[model samples]
Target: MSRAVLWTKVVAGGLLMVVGGPAFVEYIRPSDEELRKRYNPDLQKRSAEQGERRAQEFDDYVNKLKHWSKSDKSIWYAAQEELDNKRAAIEAQRAQAKEETRTQREEMRKEMLGEK
Candidate 1:
């Protein structure tokens, strides 16, 4: 092939690499906002909340480990106590939510039945 034709091909290939490469990457890997838009808002919020909860749990575990390392408490006992505390917290949260729901139902019933 002629040198002119060879150079033309090289320049075209380089330009394609420079421009098309980015376009391809952009299409293949979407931006964070684009990814967020694709999922349901509820799912995104739940995922974020779940991640935060997991991170907090991890931090708590690490802190407990540090404390256990310094103190005379056995790891098994400490771990069981932590689990019990977590269960109690979960039960408290459920109780609070259940009470709130009952309160709302009572209020709605009063409004609908026209009773005090």
Candidate 2:
């Protein structure tokens, strides 16, 4: 290419980068809260729903176990144990969420009071 054309191309490329870099970063970059919200907008609601469904399943299994023959007792107990583990995990998740919300509220309160 001619010198003038090459210089013009370089200038245009620089201009595009200068203008587009921030826009590109802004378009792709997400704040921590935004990322969390995008990934789990209704954490409490979803967790509660999942816990409810699992509890219902546990109840159904218990009822089935109650009427099942003695030979099947071990199988039913194993299933119940699995459900118990799931319930424990769900409870832990709920506790973690509660802790996070509590910390967030405390931070907001401190911000309002002009304290770090």
TM-score of 1: 0.44
Per-model clash counts, in order, read: 0, 0
lDDT tens readout by residue for model 2, 24-95:
998899886665566554885686579789999999877766655344458667667768999999999999
lDDT (10s digit) by residue, model 1, range 1-116 = 99999999999999999999999998899788788788898989987789889999999889988876776778878778878999999999999999999999999999989964
lDDT (CA) per prediction: 0.90, 0.82
Clashing pairs in 2: none
Worst 10 residues of 1 by lDDT: 67-76
After aligning candidate 2 to the native by TM-score, how far in Å is the CA of 61 from where it should be? 12
C-alpha RMSD by candidate, in order:
14.2, 25.7
| Model 1 residue 26 CA deviation in Å | 41
Report the error of model 1 at residue 89, Å: 0.5
Off by over 4 Å in 2: 1-73
